[model samples]
Target chain A: MIRRRFPWLSYLVVVTGAVLTVVPFLDMVMTSFKGAGEAGTLPYHFLPKAFDLSNYRAAIDQLDLPVLFRNSVVATAVITGSVLFTSSLAGYALAKLRFPGRNLIFRLVLSTMMFPPFLFFIPHFLILVHWPLAGGNDLFGRGGAGLTVSIAALAMPFLVNGFGIFLMRQFMVSIPDEVLEAARIDGAGEFAVWWRIVVPQTRPVLLTLGLLTFVQAWNEYIWALLISTANPDVMTLPVGIQFLQDYVDPTRTMPIVMAGLVLSILPVLILFLLLQKYYIRGVMLSGLK
Target chain B: MVNALTPTTTERAAPSTRSSSPAVDGRARSRRRQAVVAYLFLAPTLLFFAVFLILPLGFALLLSMSRWAGFDLGGIQPVGTDNFAGLFADGSTFLAPILTNTLLFALGTVVLALAGSVVVATCIDNLRFQGLWRTLYFLPIVTTVVAVGNVWKYMYEPGGLVNGVLNALGLGSMAFLQDPDTALPSVVVVQAWASVGSAVLILTAGLKSIPESYYEAAALDGAGPLTVFWKITLPLLRPSLLLVCITQFISGLQSFALITVMTKGGPGDATNVAALEMYRQAFSYGRWGPASAAAFVLFVVVLVVTLAQLWIFRRKEEDA
Candidate 1:
């Protein structure tokens, strides 16, 4: 009733805020349709003169969209699958199984989340560069470009997520112990019990963790940029588009960059929209993006 | 299946029963096996931590103290405290512009996003299609930083939408990201804009948790909407406000991806922050020692704030 009293004001504020929120995306879409010299011109126009589709063609052709797409998809899939599998398995173990030093391991996992990720960029890159025997390095991890040249570099540092394991463990802790105990008593091994019973029971949290990891890995840029810069052969969608923007002329290529961005963002946008409930819950659980 | 399982299971059982202590021995053996299985399941994750988490940390610390030019571990020259000293030494931009810029950027984002989210979220709680509004707001959050940064960068250009709006209003267009004075704030605005969605979500959740009866009681007392918000909403929303505040502050402190995409920390380092500086030091300049030291300095700032937040929240929990 209190909120109802100023309904007009509320409507005005909410509508205004929503428009402000959506306008950049709308502008990006509109700019992608602008013809050459039409964007970044004397007067900015909200809409294109005509709905041109040529920029998408240029983006695909010039930016090597296929290779970028392949790299992005492979990296995202590997990171997501690895995170989900590892999180679920480790979660089950930490939650249900008896083990020595379990407390210490759990604390270690929690502390891992506390360390800011920026601290790792320098060392992680160096570690990959010195990875022995991969990329022509020696036994001591020296004297070559190392693993940075390979596609696995895109997924390496992201594969094991501490937060994912923590989320899975928290969710699994709620599952009644008797279900696992029953499976175990029925001659089921720990692996089979986790695979059949725990995994299915914890499917919702897994989906949440999976979607979170998928979105993050898909949109990840810095490490991908670093890795792609080290070896151009492993460029992902974001890295490729950014590289093009950095090197090419902005005026002639702005629309194409916009087109590439539109294409690059569509997968995550669609995925988030379809499974937004899970994604939103995951955000809330994590408390920040 | 029975025939296949019979031999191995009997073999496993026979060893425990040989001393006529079947129950105790069997339980102990199974517990040990479970422990082994648990560790086996955890092997990959632990190995990853050993390499990525633990090793990187030790290496980062070591590198912070030693000068090395991008290659060969054997070339590291030990120079104790020099890297840290250089950051704060005379004629160093690290103390004045870089670290100060980082703090100001984080503080500005938290303030702007918090104010905006409070107003928008409180209003949206009473509106229909809340999910749609939330989803719309969350687009930037789901978006790659490259897209958000570039879009905002273009919009801040001379002939772009933001300036276009300014000219339409009979105002001169200003260079947002190019000017030293405006560059940091320009990026801060984008950061706040991109983050407001999640803040709104958290605050709205907080608003929902407040009992509707409080509003009803206020309405009966002839309280104005402003009075109701001030008296009831603000007090009850403190926890969520603090949550958004500290989390956003932490994220703001560490985030350099957007900055990298937008300005790459310059029109002469005008927009440079600690993390970006650290990144450039290593990646661009190949000064591994100084870069690692910058990272540790930034880490100490982040750690202090994080610990303060934890302590504050814990104290609040205890009081509650």
Candidate 2:
């Protein structure tokens, strides 16, 4: 039926949608180069009257891009590593392992999904203040902000993901038990079986989880804002861009802000381009389950 | 009784064989070993959850019950249920309106995005450049929220492209992000645009799973396209629709960054959803109690809605 009439409608819709989506991005890039006067002018210039790199230059000079980028990278890497390793292991165990309290634990994990994250902010902040760790004081750890102002605080909260575990478990459950038994018969230990046999088998899932964790961690703003506010040195890109907006003069800042936004998002865009297939698959898999 | 007799006879005959063989013992030992390995594999995850998720959730519940400004150690006081009281007490002034707006925004976006995605997906499903369309639509989802927010902020400026286009089309420029009436809806449009790709993908997958035989059968029965879609497509696509609706609901409720960047709940607390409101109260107003209360309220609403949806989905699955 679709093949008969209105075949051109499909092409028109696809082209129109594609143009609508990409035009904003193109506008962003063009606006990043336009002066403030030219930016707010009428009729919306598709191409900049004068191509200027000053906005990019000024943004780099004004904002702590390198430090923020490093912080973002470190935090995202740690959180991704921890989530992938832990979720995969937990997922495998939930899928294949038989234990006394396995079902109970799995159920508990599932139930945690009901708890909204906003509910934890107040308590988590208080706990961070009194956390007994490296920066913790002698009693109740009240002197210094224990986990409050560090990159560790930024990364620590998201290390254990219930969704990640659930996703991995669903994927792992489809794997045959015979493979594990064969590995066991060959005298491979549990860790060996998981590392050599199971881990290799779940590569696609791991990639999906890794890309997701990276994007999420990189884009995290609220927690980063809360924990890293005291330390200007450790701000991530999102928080940095936010603060940059406040510091820059609005009349002259539009271009720089746009430039900073472009800079901030480049990594994510590149990451998406490289791993979009895995990302889409992961979303479908996790969303379906 | 027959099974028991057979098993006993077989066991008696195989006793010598079983006793002589190491494979059975090996199997038992391997099982024990596997159990040990399973625990080993679970250790890191369990430990992380214990310290991070479990402990923090426990602490969050405790904090909700107490009155702490979150900064000072000397002012920690246990004021049980007071925070929750403040949530409802303040509901009349700002919380009620914000909650209504948020829920309304969520519903609007979900419905709009669902409709948009279905149409776009159906159209794209038969297109030649499937990959190109998918990439273009999905681009917004991949873009960082801050970047997208900033771009949209530009687009929403008084003389920007949106207003420019509006004016060009013979309609006067509307106060998209400035006016209270249009701000929330403007944000909704952006959110819908950002989310439609994923919804399309999920619905497309659902559509693909429907056997072509049904369509063939429908066509042979002289059913119109709209009839087939309504009768055949909608019913089989219920699961995906439900998933998209619930996920988009949760996402729309928790939304903050875009609003923060675009409007900052602007023009007199117009776009202040609970999450953004909580941030403002806590960081801007230093009203720890009120913010915590707001957070708890938001949490409850989301939890209840999500659970209700889950229950509905489960019931539907069972019926199927």
Candidate 3:
């Protein structure tokens, strides 16, 4: 009918949505480039009068951004690796293997998903304090807070994700049983089957989980702030940037904060660009059920 | 002939007996081996869960029942339900407003994001450069929330870009984050903007899953665009819509970074959500007992709402 004849209205809607989404980001970029004096001016200009890189340079110096970036990278990498390794293995077992208490274990893992992390803050903090690692006391095991003030603490809490296990299990269940049976018939060991057979088949899911884990760990703030308070060297990018907001002099530090924001954002943006297809697939798969 | 057959049959039978027995035994052994390997593979994940999730959750419950000063190592005295009671009594001053704000914010965000996503999804679904539009719409979802919050923090600054645009359009500048009246709503809008991308992605997938024949048939029936959308598109999209609602609710309730960065529960606690309030109590005010109680409340709220939504959706699906 006439409805299908002209779709320009649809095009208009797309353009409007795109513009609405893009404009704020463009503004952020422009504001970052603007001088501190020009930042507070009314009728905000889309383009800076004179572009400035001083903010980036100053922010790098002021925030000690290199240290923060390194800490974030190390923590995020460790956490992501741990989560991927642990969750995939658990997920494979849950989906493929017959074991006693399999359903019980699966249910327990799923139940963990419902428990809000905030509830555990006080005790988890105390647990970290009394952990026998770096902050442990003179009695060795009795003395220290373990990894509390170290980068390890940042990675430790999120090393196992119930959601990751769930997602991986769902993906693994979709694999054809014949393929697995063939591997078994070929005299492949279980580990070998998981490594050579299941892992290869499950790369997409792994990558999806990896990206999600990386993003979550990278953006995490509160836990990082709480656990890493004793060691400035272990502070992450989000916490570092947040501290910069209040620590930097309001007048002169605006640009530096903006630069920090830009630098902190670049990795995720680059990641999305590189893996947009898989990201979208992951989103659809996880979100739509 | 009988003598020759006996020799051949004996030779064949001996080999078959020899081969089949080992094969069966090997199969059984390998089955046990497979189970062992599976458990081995699962050990690391199970260990992690036991230590971090299970132990911490159990300890957290215990902590919620005790009194904890900021630095009390050996002084976690059992206080029974005092913390929970204290939280509920005077907690309303902080908790009530925060809860109300959170619910209001979540409702606003879910409704706006859903509408915007549907419109955008429908538009992109019909577009020629579909991937380009999808990427454009999805850009915000990938950008770190901290970065988004920071940028929007600037955007919401008094006489900042948002106000500048308004003033340029002959409207006066509004204190988007400073004024009590506008603060939470402003945060809600920002959240809605950040969230629409993911919602759009899901809705787009939902739209794609609708068979082309339905639309074709509807076109043959002389149905208009609105009529087709109402009758055909929406009915099929119930599942995705339900998902979007539940996810948005959870995320909104858990929202902290944006509020912490943007307002810090300011303009006289105008935008203090339960999650942020928990952070404030535990970290800022050093009221561990009260904070734990608040956190438990938040956990309960999230759990209850999520289950209720799931149940409602399940019932709807059953009826359909």
lDDT of 3 by residue, A87-140 (tens): 888999999877667898889888887776766666677666666535654443
Between candidates 1 and 3, which one is better according to lDDT?
Answer: 1
The lDDT of each candidate is 0.92, 0.78, 0.79
Q: What tens digits encode model 3's per-residue C-alpha lDDT throughout B130-201? A: 888888888777776667777887877764778788878888888888889999999888889989988988
Model 1's CAPRI class is: medium
Rank order by lDDT, top first? 1, 3, 2
Highest lDDT against the true fold, candidate = 1
Q: For each candidate in turn, give its C-alpha RMSD to the true structure in angstroms.
A: 2.9, 4.6, 5.3
Candidate 1: tens digits of C-alpha lDDT, residues B182-291 = 99999999999999999999999999999999999999999998899999999999999999999999999999999999999988878899999999999999999999
TM-score of chain A of each: 0.98, 0.93, 0.90
DockQ of each: 0.61, 0.48, 0.49
Candidate topping TM-score = 1
Model 1 alpha-carbon drift over 4 Å, by segment: B1-12, B15-20
Q: What share of the true interface contacts does each candidate keep?
A: 0.75, 0.56, 0.60
Stretches of model 3 off by over 4 angstroms after superposition? A1-6, A138-145, A176-178, A181-187, B1-32
Clashing pairs in 2: none
On DockQ, who's better, 1 or 3?
A: 1
Query: Candidate 1: deviation at residue A250, Å?
Result: 0.4
TM-scores of the models, in the order given: 0.97, 0.91, 0.91
